[model samples]
Target: MKEFDIIVCGATGYTGQLACEHLARSYGSELRWAMAGRDMAKLRSIQARFEVPSHVQLIEVDITDAAAAASLAERARTILSTAGPFANVGEPLVAACAHNGTDYVDVSGDAVWIRKMLDRYQEVAAGSGARLIFTCGFDSVPSDLGVFFLQELARERFGAPAKTVKGRIRRLVGGLSGGTLASGRASIQAAGADPKIPQLLANPFALVPGFDGPAQPVGNAPVFDPDVKSWVAPFILAGMNAKSVHLSNALLGWSYGKDFTYDEMIMLPGAEDADSAREAADANIWSNVVRALQIDLKPGEGPSEAELAAGSFEMIFVGRTASGQEISTTVTGEGDPYALTPRIVAECAVCLTQDGTTATGGVWTAAAALGEPLRRRLEQRAGMSFSVA
Candidate 1:
């Protein structure tokens, strides 16, 4: 028997603390969960601040320590990690869980690092019955599951699967977390330092091995999309989000079709968006992403709670069936995207520990691993809603 139902590693970080708050406020003593990090002092402070139930364990976990990670993995039925640039500290913990049959989830956007995990541990995880779901937060959950939701709707409405799905960022208001920026910088630095890494990062099918689909839309440039009739700017995280969606398709036995194509962009209304405006808009968005990736910030530092509360995003996905029937679905969340991440990821941890999940092991996407059960949980508990548009 596991000692706890869930163990939140890196519970002292910015988003990690929010996850701690959510558990304390939502489940209290009803849940068997732990607040874990490398520092016991910081964990104690969070415990004091949140008044985490006395029964809730607080354990120090240094992901680098193989023995410590194994012990934690063995004791926890589920693990949610809020730490990143996971490429640096995630391997040991992930390996431990995969080897020990403990489910794991993380708000990771690092496709390159995930690719490594897939190569090294996918088989091990499968054999051990560990369902490692990555990008449980805003980066790919909304995108990956958004596509899954649309495709399911397509099957029901059109009697065929969608041949393509275009995800549009209808509205997004939030600051990127310092941890996200740090992850981006680390990825950039690693890519620059290694010649082969850029090739993998640039590939649209980076997460899926042994198969490459048709050429994808060049989501890198701004274009006037007639479908949405808007001047769309390139979304910075589209690369990461799209890969997860593609992996879901692969894992779901190619249900979206082998030639399925998907893309994402930030929508700008066409009323006044001309070539010049699009150019300016693209520069502005990309510059902010570039700045965030280059600027350094401490791991625990980020926008104030008020700022995170001010952030929000809406994603609209349009799925086109081979018969030309189109189905649209919208996913909206309040507060900053990062502000809402803890809720999504926390629910993911809880979802994995529940009675009706984990079909098999291996690195998986939310679409394949959790699906409707997860969707329902997000709708009911995370203040996120999904609706046909």
Candidate 2:
């Protein structure tokens, strides 16, 4: 039997490195975990960066090496993959875990890939006792788990769940990873490779059950009403986040509601800062330019420590129940969005492997695997918190 409780696959990568660092700093002596990747030198360097116990092993394995991957899977109770543009290489690791009964999580925002994986290996994971979770990062955390929190808040206040839940990025200033950009490019490339892939990406109900509606473009509108306190813009993250939360609702059997509708927008502080809201609108322009130029901030290549220290984000969610009662919540995290995502992802990995509170033997999401535990953990440990407003 393997000695470690968890394996941080792709540990040489940016986010993976951060997870390793976090684990070493916070849970090193206690949690039996290892760093894994195809590059043994890089893994050794990563391990050297920290003063982890000698017992923390380093496993060499590539996603393409089926036997090595299976051996890697067999060595750990759970796997945390930071490998990106996951559509290309994610399947192999997921498949290996499914075959080996090892739990898994990844910082993938590729909903299309996730849907395909669930369709292909959900049963395998269930039978093998592996609990697979995707979108364990900032991409879906605020949105996926935020919606879950909103529904709970709504039910507590209005005696029922919300019919429409809106998640808007209130204030955000952050960076992106080369890995994430690569994933996006790969997704686009894969979409181009197969014309049907675009349609799959646009499928609203692709992962959600009974969601047969047409796809709506992200960030298409701006308005305000009584549900929340401020104006709303097209929430750029809504496309992926909504699907994740909805899928969880579907898999959890209407915990949120069959009529549950989710949209994301940017929240203006108080309807008084049109300029700031417009600045928020123009925020992703540079990211778009970077994507176009194929320029990415790779591992150890992100914003300086000073920049990360200065960056922060705020998200507000408004929920309206069937009875017309309303409730609201906010999720705020300080530091660079890209940087913080890895921290959340790492903590989520730790929670999955060490928390001992999640369901067993199935594919899951942040909302399903950690759920309330995640919310509290983020609040208590990950510099994120949620509260009614």
Report the number of the highest-lDDT candidate: 1
Candidate 2 lDDT by residue in tens digits, 120-222 = 9988988988889888888888788888888877777778998877777767877656676667677777878898877766665678644674334355645
Q: lDDT score, residue 162, model 1?
A: 92
| Candidate 2: worst-modelled 10 consecutive residues by lDDT | 284-293
> Which consecutive 10 residues in model 1 have the weakest lDDT in total?
279-288
lDDT of 2 at 53: 65
Per-residue lDDT tens digits of candidate 1, residues 176-264? 66788788888988999999898997788989898979999887767788777777877888889999999999999999999999999
Each prediction's whole-model lDDT (CA): 0.86, 0.76
Estimate the TM-score of every prediction. Answer: 0.96, 0.90
How close to the true structure is residue 98 of candidate 2, measured as C-alpha lDDT? 94
Q: How does candidate 2 fare on TM-score?
A: 0.90
